[model samples]
Target: MRFVWRWRRNPLRRRSDVVEAWAGVAAVVLMLVLGTAAGWAVGSFAHGALREAVRQQQQHRHLVSAEVVRSVTGTPAEPDHESTTGREGYGRFLARWQDPDGVEHTGLVALHQAPGPADRFPLWTDDEGRIAGRPMDRATAVVHAVLAGAAAAAGAAGLVEGVRRVVVWRLVHRRYAQWDREWQQAGHTWGRADAGS
Candidate 1:
């Protein structure tokens, strides 16, 4: 692994040793710079795109008051019941809301509390008065971007390390085979006046 001695005056240093040393340094430097740059670029682009989407949703989506038409109960079966907000949720209920343009829409709504007939609840609507989920927020967008960037960096690092290992291992094998060939050539001719060093 020590390459400094290879460049110095040495009887045992082979050309392959110098090549391996330089290649190792180059590979490490390149991986660091390229991987980090790629990760940052991907992260920044993703963040900008996601933030724009959130902005559009916030601008167009509106909260309208709706009246529950049917009583809905029972917790829905969820594969992942874990809630990040640490709050329990109520079931869905049928509700109707009138849009700003005077068009009315009805859909299933999830509420924190049980809803009876004529109970008022807040409903999210898109620009065309269609029922929609809650609008995306800036915080969620940033979190997603950060996670994506980290994943990119990790993936790049893993791939680079795997390739480096394979190359180094092959180089070691080749060096050993070269040593064996040299030994076989000089095995029976050592210390002879005709077999010169």
Candidate 2:
């Protein structure tokens, strides 16, 4: 407590103290901005890259086809009807079928839109006849791009703010130096006058 009081009363420590405080504030703000940008960039990049890699691996690959034995909405409604919509309606599809090698496989595909009950979407399987990956829609790609760009912008803004604060500190320090010199000169002059008298 005594140390804190002494520091608060110390005139020589005042300018340096203000500069240190402002520097700490600038550092915190910069960290927040950079951290947010980095996180967003990583998330966007991972999503797009993984999706594309999976799609490429599945391209030109063939799978045994089968008819939809049953179609039902994802909700709590009972399975009662067949959907006639195009590929756009195929939000999520579950297919149960057998491969050419007499092996059975169940595949799940997530589509941008809902697919019809009878719509024939391509299924890609590995050597083991396991469903590997599916193609991603254009809308999902766009979202990833947007998120990455936003993160870059946030990082840039943080750097700019940090630099601005540093410049402000330099200016404040220069002014404080000039004021200190002036005050010391005035005190010396007063002392000389008192001694002469």
Candidate 3:
């Protein structure tokens, strides 16, 4: 009468039904356990890797004061999209800054606002004094790690669900085929009144 009948001793319960029920239970349990384990493991690994990268960036990247050499007049057709500063009133200039090694380097830098004569702004550079983006912050690294962990958990759960669906699909087909065979056998003696006697 109820779906739970599959788990109890009943004449109407077929072997395939019992197997399907157990399989469904197993799938739910596995999805939860595997998803959680995968999420935690991937999250831990990603956090450790990102933290190490942050440390390396902090060690190798230096922020130094750069003087604006000359302003590039007129907005170029292509602006520096990667500029951390907002693009409105954006100013492009040839800037010079000294590296940690006391070597001077000049490059085109984008600023949020036009600079006055002898104006200076902070710029990030590598050891060789080439312009570089700001180093990754700890908060950003943590957020990325959390996102990766969530993705991994979802992927694990999806994989488990897919496998369960495939197994259940096969079980259902087998059950249907078994029923078809029984029906065909019964059809052979359908008109015989003494068939069951």
Candidate 4:
């Protein structure tokens, strides 16, 4: 209790201490803001690159006639097949085809349409292999990246703020200690005068 009173009376415990503490807090806040922006930029660039790669692969794809070896139902159905077959489920078809080099390849194809047990279907394949469809557009990929980046930034900001508050509290406590010591020395000198009287 006496220590609290002495600290309150000390002139060295100035308002500037509060200002400096707030300044440190502001610096940390600024770092979090900048980090978030940088993270978003990086994520956006990566997503755009991925989408472009998909688009290029789709553009180079070639169409070929394939024989359906078998047909199987898929879970959660294909959207295109839903309207035609009046069934809301996905379908898978096993197909075999000869490439331009006359090499036979067998793979599974997911169709939006229901096929009979042994129906023929047009298959599309790129130089490397078959793909579901064209790559996603850049705008869609960017939106997803931005959202993910922002979420990460928000989490980081929370951690930084917590650490900054603890540091500031410790600094404030140190300043209070110094002020208390100065006041106690002054009080001791005054007490000696009262004793002599």
Give the better candidate number (2 or 3) by TM-score.
3
Residue-level lDDT for 24 in candidate 4: 64
Q: Estimate, for each residue in 1-197, the C-alpha lDDT of model 3 and write its tens digit.
A: 55588899988889988888888888889989999999999999999999999999899999999999998766453444235434567777878899998988887788887897579999988888887789999999999999999999999999999998998899999989999999999999998999982
Runs with alpha carbons beyond 4 Å of true place in candidate 2 = 1-102, 105-128, 131-135, 190-197
lDDT tens digits, residues 1-197, model 4?
53243336467546646555565657577666866776676677767776777678557766677787887554344454212234346467777876656678887667676777667777766565443444456566777777767766776666667666776677779778977998887777775756462
Q: Give the poorly placed runs of model 3, Cα more than 4 Å off.
A: 1-3, 73-91
Clash pairs, model 1 backbone: none
Give the best candidate by lDDT.
3
| TM-score, cand. 2 vs. native | 0.39
lDDT of 1 by residue, 1-197 (tens): 26678677688887777777777777788678867977898889999999999999899888899989895556454333121222466666777899878798876666677767998977778888777668899999999998888788777877777777787788899999998998989988988898886
Clashes of each: 0, 8, 0, 4
Please give each candidate's TM-score.
Answer: 0.71, 0.39, 0.82, 0.50
In candidate 1, stretches whose alpha carbon ends up further than 4 angstroms from where it belongs are 1-14, 72-90, 183-197
**Candidate achieving the largest TM-score:** 3
Give the CA lDDT, 0 to 100, for residue 14 in model 3. Answer: 90
The digit string of per-residue lDDT tens for model 2 on 1-197 reads 53354347565665655555566566667667766666567767866785685476556334556434345456342232223223444555666666657688764554454456766655555556665434445666667766766677666667767776787678678878888998887777675756462
Question: Per-prediction RMSD in angstroms?
Answer: 4.8, 12.0, 3.3, 8.5
The whole-model lDDT of each prediction reads 0.78, 0.59, 0.86, 0.64
Clashing pairs in 3: none
